[model samples]
Target chain A: MAFSLLHGVHVPHRKNTRDMAAVRMDAPKTVVIPMSMHIGAPAKPVVKVGDTVKVGTLIAEAGGFVSAPIHASVSGKVTKITDYLLSNGTTVPAVVIESDGEMTPDETIAPPVVDSRDTLLEAIKRSGVVGLGGAGFPTHVKFSVDLGRIEYLVVNCAECEPYVTSDTRTMLDRVDDMKTALVAMKTHFGIRNIVVGIESNKKAAIKSMMGLMNEVVATGECTFTVKVLPSVYPQGGEKVLIYHTVGRVVPVGKLPIDVGCIAVNCTTLAAIGAYLKTGMPLVEKCVTVDGGCVKEPGNVIVPVGTAMSEVFEFCGGLTEAPDKVIYGGPMMGITVPDTSAPILKNTNAILALSKKETKLPKTTPCIRCGRCLNTCPFGLSPAAIARAYDKRDTVALDKLGVQACMECGCCSFVCPANRPLVQTNKLAKVLLKEEKAKEDAKA
Target chain B: MNTQLKLSVSPHIHSGRSTRRIMLDVLIALLPATAAGAVIFGLRSLLVVAVTVAACVGFEALFSLIAKKPIPVGDLSAAVTGLLLALNLPANIPLWQCVVGSLFAIVVVKGLFGGLGANPVNPAITARVFMLVAFATLTKAAFPTIVDTASSATPLAAEKATSLTDLLLGLHGGAIGETCAAALLLGGVYLLVRRVITWHVPVAFIGTVFLTSFIMEGMDATAALAAILSGGLLIGAIFMATDYVTSPATPWGKIIFGLGASLITFLIRYFGSYPEGVSFAILFMNILTPYISSWTRRRIFGMGGSKA
Candidate 1:
């Protein structure tokens, strides 16, 4: 029911590897498992140097309730335990394992015994599956919600950010796994309606998922439908996806579950299905390694903790000296200043852009054009927020809900004057928080 | 390699586009019009353009040097203003006058107001207006084509008439470049094709000029047509008035600006002291751009009401 504003920038998608043949990498000789992969506290290493570990073995234990545990992808002996750099540039404690290449299986937990009285919370905790699509929040913590009157179970299939197509390719390659995962999630959580939302940009993905859903229906399964959303950047965001697919807006400062709906990424569901079926712990993931600077730009199935250098070598190394290298898609992705940073869990894509292709305008003054206002899905005035921050006007910024900015880079993308709206807003937010803290201390 | 690069966050990608590229594009778009101006107005016009451009670039470079700011002359904003000042001038204007105009434009109007995108008014137009007021007789002297070395007044000098063909071709007495309607049209088309500008400003401005002048001429359609065709209306409407940073943001605001400019120019030509009003009309509308932008800004989400 909501109409989007005008003058959306038509940037080149550059999803070169999406249709290219998907390749699988041979197990690397060594993998550096970083202790901190997820958003929460860094996981503590349970293994020491020279300790032999098998595939699916828990090498790092969860440090806190918010953190998720790490598993070994290959049977290996821990060669060293030290701090190593991640793709995000921060150094964290990592378990360096030299793989035996045999991929020996580790000890497994007993299968779930279904009892009507058995709570869904305990099953999720036992499985050890976290959200596999970027934000690696523990799945059990999300599923352990109060369920007196829950309604919508939204599966986010909208890979809106350009160039990262792991989810689309996964849906096409493994629809059965996705469906099964959705059914399992539905049964485990006791949710009624489930909506699979895919951006209409991927016609093949939409068709494959539709066929799979029809197969479920022909076998007399209950209704679960897939809705095709209009292709818009950042449509994969939980709040935006919810609004686009199901005519509902997640309240300001509230989660999707707060509105009786819980959204999960498509790749996450597929991983859940794979984990449940094969009894394998979360390890390797499909990552898109393509850009203008990449000699052999393609998608490769890689294990977690693979060094970026090895992956680039596998893909055929640099075509030219790359000016910049990014870990994820361009819109919301971060820049890797160091090439040695290892790709951890939730690493989706590695993009290396040539200098000519990757040049960005030197930021100029804000002309107050309001193009940022038009393009923002949240309907926040980024230009005004930016203007207020220019003068350190905290009151005006708070009035504009500067905190609500998802830092999605949409505003920056559309700005003709080339102002770094999100980056400036980030600084303003930190300063505002610090100012509040100082006031609290004074009081 | 023992070189350890600085470690940063996830989005390691960039597109090589810099401020230099954008400014270069504008300079490229202005090339055709600059050539047309040079050819029509002779080496004297070329001399003025060269002097103004050199002055602008020199001033910008000198300021950055003295103040220890990065030399932003590479952005080509100073050059753009230089080219614009040349277009707004008569071929006979002295070289020192052009230099003064360039200094005022690049330094006082642009650098003083915050350079490039932050300038409130189009710097070139500001310089033209400033010169017009300061050196009225020198600035207003019209230089007709020298077939037998006779100084003639411009077609707009008298409230009589001019042929559309004369206006279309460069066969009239006026500013060095602005007299050629054909050249202005060609430049406008090139800019539109390059996606450097939108059609809102030019279309509205020219449209309003035509309609307003037509109404003001009353019974004399020839005079109406001549008024629209004469002066610097074509050049100002297509080029100077539609400056991306100075123009209105909204489609409706652009239309309002077009109407406001046309109405003011018509009133000035019909009833005011000045026989031509293109420069003043555009400068007046430039002041209203901010208000027009705010009024026409898309409503902020959820402040007024929740629409879901």
Candidate 2:
């Protein structure tokens, strides 16, 4: 029973459109592509205003080695080089492109030569691919990990958040692309082990992967296993996923590569596979649309820079006025200021929750029930973290492992007192980092 | 959609388990023991419980009104405190003493320290000890009018405290809720099944008491069994000592708290002049909760050594 601390909470998997095939939406009248989609230096705009661009045209170059490039999602004229406000209260330069009603592909597109590990990394960097699992980290940066020391390729298909099933479609409909990407990574890096991690609720997607596994075995690998974990919320969390699939505990402040594993999302790998074979960069995404205020719930394939208004209308626009419109699942989703905000590269699902659906209970005094300590998959004590943060005790914050908190929101969701626990954990991490910066300056 | 979009934080959905709902579950779990107490001591005990509950709720409302805070009577914690204090009292005690005990439990022990989770001691258990010293007719256990039995200080130390069946069945002399081992065990199972309480504290406390008594009785299993089943050990370990606010939240802390409590309980009952030591032992542990919790703090995951 002591092992229960490492367990996560059970979240309701509200997969309303898991069985529906995705419908490809037509190009909208306009698109707004932002430069700072991933967590690195913002990409620099390469195309000027009034420049004519086609789909897959390079509009922005990588600002640094840690950044990714951006491509035009539709054939259009660059109307304005203005700024777009993000949810973090800061604005970044955005390219407003008005479509020409004809989604034309660039004529100069051609697949890159991929004979070795160096070519694979360069091709991935040019493909404009990032983590599609909502992190938006540059995919090429992850592939450049310790090459020979890597033991397993853990593909995360665990779409554990409720009302989000974009990865399920990737597993069901894009297996060929996934298999090609897996085989390419395995043969180039000589990594024998590959594990596709999925939850038990998606039976159809598991069966499809099983069929694809038989075909991928001939290409190369040591063991190809489908680890079906329990349908727990945050099962796909990077550390939790690595621990569940490879049976290794990534130490505090350490990456998965330190433990001989390279974790990548299933959709990110499939996008890379498509780019490697067809020479087309990432321009479109399959978004899951469903929530309490939605009249019609399904998946739609739309261009990457489309606005939430156009995407919602494509899914038979929201039924009623939404009190909250988030950019992903309800657990860790970013709430946009309004529906007029354009989608980013890592936008997986857009939810418009009604007022009743998002209503939280009145907060009461803490009863010291210990549920928050028990609910965290990492066994971190959110209650104690909140106490230390209130006092601004940086020394105590570091001792409690506040940086290990993944902001999964499990403790906040299960608190009977309705304490804003995870939010406090996030603030505590920032405070500790500031303290370290000040100490370094003094030294 | 609309311009009136609310931009709150993550985790918009909740588990729907409020403090009131948890308190409601606890109140429901205490039903079987209340019924057995009524059957053993007659309807007069029920009247005492009702008066005590009403007084507790009234006093809580009064205190909150005076303090100009949002009244927490809606959380039902006051009702729980009253019911617990009443059951620990003698069934035939005067109704005015019931009111006095309710005041001590709510306004003095609980509300004065700040309501709900702020008290350093278990309010009901502490109030019971206060009454035991302040009142004269506190130890004489009440029996049904039909049974011609002699009342004693407690079933633990009486000359006529024979017949294990009478002790288990609540036909002996004891507190209103403590006599019937069978009824209290049923209620304990209910709380465990509903997950209102964990098993660490109750199991450790009861197991320690049983083991110590077994060794003291020269390895006689029957005497040890009778030792635990008598007195108020079951009610104290399961219901009174397991209060969330005063008890330790970590697993190891809870076990240590329980073991320390059993050690003191056995010392007093074995050597001291009192026949019952459960309430006093719990009060002592409650005072040491902060130190115990800090000493037994759980290690975070991925922090160097063993698995958390």
Candidate 3:
């Protein structure tokens, strides 16, 4: 029931672009915006082929309360509407647009009036903002927590993953927008405590926020503090951040709201503030473009749906042929299928790693070093979960709490034998789900 | 989709510490002990160590080839086993007998049980026990004929054990590596520094022996100190009992194992026929590692339980 703040692995903070402010890139020839960028339902396409659309125009509507709408990041004509393949290999309907190169904003774009909590959440839903830290969960759903249940609002800017600094840029560059969101939330939610969680390694971002901390709290009676956490990987995880900030464990199979907290990504909050002020929806993203193979690496403010290859090219392209192009940090990033896959709304960084960085050694037998379990942030025994998975013993897997694994890859990262521990944990969770499904059917 | 782009799982990076690197560290850590053994037991000790190492690696390679598996001699784990087994044996033992012991360790105990990291008990420790029982020369030479030695028998085997000073400096007759307490301690420090092993098992194992022996011998601290310095207690406690594959993985499990091993060792040393019980104690605890590990698992976050 208690949190071990000392848990989690110490990873290299390869913040190569920490000093580089994001540059806005020119619109490419075309863009392929996917409909299913958020966690829940895929947005239904409202535009057909040959339909003219402008920047900030809603091309797709939210499928459900949990889903987020899709907006045009660049003024263009609807070139095609077809199923597109995501990096995870899932096929979802996407809207393809041919950019006119003018980068024109939609004429109808205007800030919505948010006089109450419901309207604030409604404005957030209309903004199409998701967890821009790469989780892709709709931000409005998290914002719409029960008023009394949410006690602390945590701005998670930890950016604990290696080589990602978009959140750092948000803190350093978008102070006004972030403060606006904070003041808005304080007015509407009436939350007493506000904690800004960031790694200690990010001193610049820490200082940047520290200089302006009083601005948000000055409007109302609030306890706002910048909690500088240890620079450990997965410290930015919602559960870990919530625990480290509020010192409360969001119980197993529960949400942060259940623990009197709501942790949102700093960039996600910035986007909501920008949306409220300028009336433009979530269109552009500031992405950290760096890895071992990149020729020149920095942050780039690219429109959503721009092909990753174009983004990489704009960042000076690769020095060598990248053997693995991941869409996030090396610790928990998913490798893109190719350079052509369009960057999604939640994408914070694009890494092009050479063989030296991506090539894994031959996996030897488990030496039982306990490093996997020892370094696990949640204290889960990945080695035991691995055994239970091998035996298909669902009871053992459940008892080991396989579902608690957040797949931060800390276990796999520290494995001396190079075992795919987090990968096995993911599979074991799936197997446990299947077994439980069978039991439910029988019952 | 580009085939050149790897679609591997998450965690595209590694710590780069391999099993080979770990085994290499173990070999490096054993260097000081080997030198001390050679100095104390004479030139014959180095020969026995070299022959046993060669024999173990040879047997592992030969068995792997025969089993149609890739030869794993490059990992140097077999070399580590050979050195550990050599240290446990008498320095004056025949080189051919060393080969036999190495074969039992690398092929029979290790290879037959699914090779490295898969054996239920430590191959080197198990093979030492095996050779002790199977060969009468090992038992007969508990008291060596060498006149230059301080005593006819080892400090523990003799009725009048050597003084703490003699035992600490290893100025007595015993197994090649086990006699030199100073050397073994130096090697243990190296291993601890390199993080090849943790302080949990070594500290607990030696602490339990010291505490229990001090209590059992009417609070005689001198007698307890001699007990650890003599025989294979230092080498066994620091090296063999901390084997990652055979020992419990969790910290609490390791401590439990150390305590359990200490109990068995005291039972054997005080009442049983064997004058030294470190090897047997470690081997007994090795078999119980799986159970200890299951009982002392790190508590999962948000789960309702203690230990499990």
Candidate 4:
């Protein structure tokens, strides 16, 4: 079937570990699991300091319906419950566990009994599954939406971020588990159509997914389709993937389910599959650890809460002191303040970049080239929006649709003048929010 | 562990294409034409280009210093303006007049109006127009002698017996760079390939001129072809009319700007007194850029239907 091409920038796909199998690392000496890995409310710590816990132990429970629970990633005693600094510069409560050197499984760890939709969602929530595609939205909350409205279940295998191939590794290493999860979704959730959107760059992953689809077809399951998307940056974006595969636009401020679709990350599905089989919650993650500064770079399966410094050491420590270490893909990744931050549930890649790679380009005046306009996936006039923002014109900002910017960094990346368009877009959004709050208070 | 890590926004990487780099590309693309102009009009043509460029850069730096703005001479935008302004002038025109034109362009037309991207008109075209008005007798009477043949009038003014080959090869009497159609085309192609400029404005502008001249002259193909090849049409369309700051940013806006410039050019060439109308037409259209840009704002992706 012909799928419409979605708009996105053609970024360099530095999938250095596309062919490298992920090697599992033993738990670090200490694990610092943050209480707020997922969006919405932060999880509240239930385990106290010095309390003994094992892998898959519930260390923190969901603080709200939109939040996901946190699990003990190491067999250890809780060292401390302390405030941890996130990459975004906010402090969150984190439980630090000192490894006991004997990896033990929790006594309650066993295969989940899934007979109905409620049981499946409960099992998913219990497993602490979230969107492993970087946004970290709670997975059970996504599935809890009206299942009848979701017509297409899009498996986002299009790991289009540069220097990140963890999803590709998951698709190659966990094909059977992915198929099992898909079949479960088909039979239980009543999702009729399943679309696996993989970028053409990942030929091995696409081939493996297609093989799974054939096996599923033999069983006479729901219609399974593998949509090959162009290798464009942000092709894995929820809205872009939906538009390309299902030919539907999730209008501004609407969820994917609003367009009769539910998009799940490829690794997220693999996690769900693994949980259904082994009852192991999100304890470890397959992270692609490769960047310019590293001596040896490849994908490694790291336990959650492992310090980034430990991950870098496992990858043969930096050749030179890195100027920046980014979490997730280079395009939309957040630069961590330091390597002391622990890997979260959604952390896909930890890039240790050299000075040359991280040095900010000198900004010049905008030449009014309109390349930013042409490159923005959401069709925002970044140049005009920057002007409106600088002038503090709230009405112009509203009319220009500054709030619709996805902050994918395409505009800033492509600007020849090196104008900080994405930075200005972010500021514009904040300004608009502040103005709106003031108006609301007045009203 | 002691190394400090930089913390900024999301995009930690850039394409590294700077304003200086973009200006350098424009300069590189203009090399063939500048070389051709020098070769065709003798070593004096090179002196004209050099003086104008130096004068323009000096004026820009002086004005920037006086105005307390950052000296942006390194970006090579002033050099581009100087080269363009020099190319539009007669080879035998006085060097002092060239300096005056450069000063007018950089100081009044550009620097006074917030500099560079904030200017409302193309600096080179506005400067050319200024010189044409201020030094009318000198500019009109200073046409270069073509290969020792003393032809007083340019090919456009002569209007009767000039060969198309001479026009294409730029062997006839004209301004320094405007005479070489082949060289200008090569440079234009380079700019297009480098993505420094798009083909929309140049194609539409040249196409409109070709079509309008053909219709105006009652299907005279030679007249229409000569009209395009002669005067400053090629240089203006390829270089000045497509100035990133002065021209519209949207594709539709560029097309409209091109068409409007071509129509005015045709009107001035056929009905008005000037033999060459490229400078005035482009300057007039540059003034309407904001309006054209607003009217032709691209229909944003996934925003209602594909309509303005």
lDDT of each: 0.73, 0.86, 0.87, 0.87
lDDT of candidate 3 over A1-443, digit per residue (tens)? 45458378888788889999999998988999999998998999999999999999999999998899999999989999888987667899999999999999999999889888888888998999998989899998887767888889899989999999999999999999998788888887777888999899999999988865888767768989998989988899888888788787777788988878888899998999999898999999999999987888999999999998898889887788888999889998988768888878999999998888765667888888888888888889898788788998999988899999899999888887787789999999889889999999999
RMSD of candidate 3 to true structure, Å: 2.1
By TM-score: ranked, best first: 4, 3, 2, 1
Q: Which regions of candidate 3 fall more than 4 Å away from where they truly are? A: A1-3, B1-3, B140-147, B150-153, B159-165, B305-308
Could you tell which candidate, 2 or 4, scores higher by DockQ?
2
Per-model TM-score, in order, reads: 0.86, 0.96, 0.96, 0.97
Indicate the worst ten consecutive residues by lDDT in candidate 4 chain A. A1-10
Residue A47 Cα positional deviation in candidate 2, in Å, after optimal superposition: 1.9
User: In lDDT terms, how accurate is model 3?
Assistant: 0.87
Which candidate gets the maximum DockQ versus the true structure? 2
Interface RMSD of 3: 2.9
Model 2 quality (TM-score)? 0.96
Q: Provide the DockQ value for model 2.
A: 0.63
Residue B227 displacement in candidate 3 (angstroms): 1.9
DockQ for every model comes to: 0.25, 0.63, 0.57, 0.57
**Interface RMSD per candidate:** 4.1, 1.8, 2.9, 2.7
- Let me know the DockQ for model 4: 0.57
